[model samples]
Target: MIRHLVLFKLNDGVVRDDPRVVEGARIFASLGEKIPELRFWECGWNVSDRPIAYDFAINSAVEDAEALRAYVEHPEHQAGVALWREFATWVIADYEF
Candidate 1:
């Protein structure tokens, strides 16, 4: 299996309560149900206020690299990404287990 993790930092002046950000989070929150390749999914806003902490995070898993690719290319996933691009920047890591 492969674990896909992502951390997102909101852009300056962007808050989680903003309509676009809320919609973006909603889109992502639903991707696990919409994408067949997603074997596991957990995502949420951070609870901490640490200076180095990212504002949001996603923890997901797939069967393999191919499944991961399919998840990345899925239309619903792409739509969420497009919306996030306007308000945040993110970093990701994928690893096999």
Candidate 2:
């Protein structure tokens, strides 16, 4: 399986409660149901307030690299990325297990 992880930091002045951010989170939260390639999905706001902490995170698994690619190219996923791109910047890492 491929474990795909992501950390997101909201752009300056963009709070989590902002409607756009909330909607973006909702979009990601719904992906487990929408994408067949997603074998696992967990995402949420970070509880820590430390300066090094990210505002949100995603931990997901897929069957393999092909499935991971499908999930990444999926239209719904692309849409969600577009929305978040407006208010956040993110980092990601993927590994096999």
Tell me, by lDDT, which candidate is best. 2
Residue pairs in collision within model 1: none
Residue 27, candidate 1: how far off, in angstroms? Answer: 0.4
lDDT of 2 by residue, 1-97 (tens): 9999999999999998999999999999999999999999999999997999999999999999999999999999999999999999999999999
| TM match of model 2 to true structure | 0.98
How much lDDT does each candidate structure score? Answer: 0.96, 0.98
Scored against the true structure, residue 89 in model 1 reaches a CA lDDT of 98
Residue lDDT tens for model 1, 1-97: 9999999999999988999999999999999899999999999999998999999999999999999999999999999999999999999999999
CA RMSD of all predictions: 0.4, 0.5
lDDT comparing candidate 2 with the true structure: 0.98
| TM-score of predicted structure 1 | 0.99
